[model samples]
Target: MSDRVRLKGRFIKKKVRDKQVKAVAAMREAHLSKNVPRSPPNLKFSFDGRRIVDMQYLSEHLKCIKCKKDIFLRNTVEESRMGLNCILNISCEECSTLTRVHTGKMHGTGENKNRVDVNTKAVLGAVHSGIGETALNKLLVCLNVPPISANLYKRYEREIGPAIEAAAKDSCREAAKEEKQLVIANVDKLCQEM
Candidate 1:
């Protein structure tokens, strides 16, 4: 079924290279040349914003766990935020696999679920500072960060408040025992001298 030409007593195959294909290839090359790789964003580390980063901004820099290829920000499925913790559910561009990436390391101390330690600490800081929810929210706003709601703060309060109190009580008891021991030793030395 080839396009052949008979000249004299021989057949010459027709050239398949067309101008349209060459034009298309040239256009493709030009388009590809325009898409130069961009340099990664310079991220500054801050105590308040240490673990959390904008996922969409860092998407191009992020590699897929499944294929070890690049993941695009456009394929983002969900951006879940819990106080200072953030988890991005994104799909891989090459493998189409879904992966969940956390903004900060999980605490692994929760009884039911593992959450970021920063969140618990944030709540603790608020409670310990006697600022409470409203004040904590104001501070976060001043820091230009998301606010931790009163409900979440209360949830953390219920979890860590008892522990904090118990720790303080134990520390006081230890200090009292040490002070009594010191007084007894001083008295014993004085008696020995007499």
Candidate 2:
């Protein structure tokens, strides 16, 4: 290996050793059953509201969709959408999923709405590509139900679309307003307590 590669590897190994020690100590303090931190890590992101959990904490909590095994996000890919820095991608051991993190409670509604939109798009794309219908058929077959055709899938979308959009919009607005009020109230309370 090149000198640079060797030096980088050594640095990473040392960092990993230090982190492992800290993690072990934290786990011991929290009781051995909990291998992760009880309190969220000190991490700040602009879009993430005050109530948002740190990425480190989230990474600790994330589980693989397939195996349901705990996984860690090793890298983050950032992207700008709606003029915010969203976590566009993350790399984990088993699989990677797209993520969008918003900072502070004030933005929770907006964040939730964004999540809904993303989920809707994902589902729609799956359906359009026949993946969702095929998967549904497989599931139905397991339950001994009749299979469905792609043409009939539009009916499902039509039935669900308006409700989903309305609910998502309402939820987003309500959440954002509520979170903003809560944060302001907390700040006031903190001042009074101090």
Candidate 3:
């Protein structure tokens, strides 16, 4: 046998190990490359209008006060319309009794009927829709409906504004906490890689 090696450099024993060493080094490189950092993909946002709840208002009209019979909403504009609020005159079919149902249910007892939540919600919706009392009044006027008095609108804002602000602050705090957790998780992953 003629031991003639051309690929290996001068060594104690002549050998051709070039191809084997190259293959081993390539495999090591391939294994180590799995831990390399990669660029993150860009995120996207999709926005839409606020959602509305499909409330079944017909259930609330059942059982009139005076006669305890089935009732229906009085559809007359004069009777139902009350600015942002309304009156649902649930008329008893049996006794013809007119049972008044406010836009919001009565909150308190005899003397202190302090606030109507429906009115507050209306004002809040108007504010969120990038409008205020004046704009609401204008819209109502254009629709040929009685406008909510400016003073009453202001009163609702005054009562519910603080609650809105508090809710916003809570939401912001929760978002920040979640962001911080995500950042910490990323940092931990990076440290583990190192």
Q: Best-fitting candidate, measured by TM-score?
A: 1
Can you write out model 3's per-residue Cα lDDT over 55-132, one digit (the tens) per residue?
A: 344356556776576665432122343345565554455655556655444343354355655667778888779899
Candidate 2, number of clashes: 10
Q: What stretches of model 3 exceed 4 Å from their correct place?
A: 1-59, 62-64, 70-82, 88-98, 103-114, 186-194
Estimate candidate 3's alpha-carbon lDDT, on a 0 to 1 scale.
0.61
Off by over 4 Å in 1: 1-65, 70-77, 108-111, 188-194
For residues 77-189, could you state the per-residue lDDT of candidate 2 as single tens digits? Answer: 44233211123333334444333433211122432343323233434665556677668656546754344455554544654567678888999999999999998879978
Please give the lDDT score for candidate 2. 0.48
- Position 99, candidate 2: lDDT: 38
For model 3 the TM-score comes to: 0.50
Provide the clashing-pair count of each candidate structure.
0, 10, 0
Write one digit per residue (lDDT tens) for candidate 1, span 70-146. Answer: 87655666666788676666677566666677665565554837755677888888778788888888887877777
Model 3 lDDT, residue 140, Cα: 65
Superposed Cα deviation of residue 1, candidate 3 (Å):
99
User: Ranking by lDDT, best first?
Assistant: 1, 3, 2
> Candidate 3 — which pairs collide?
none
Which scores higher on lDDT, 2 or 3? 3
What's the TM for model 2?
0.30
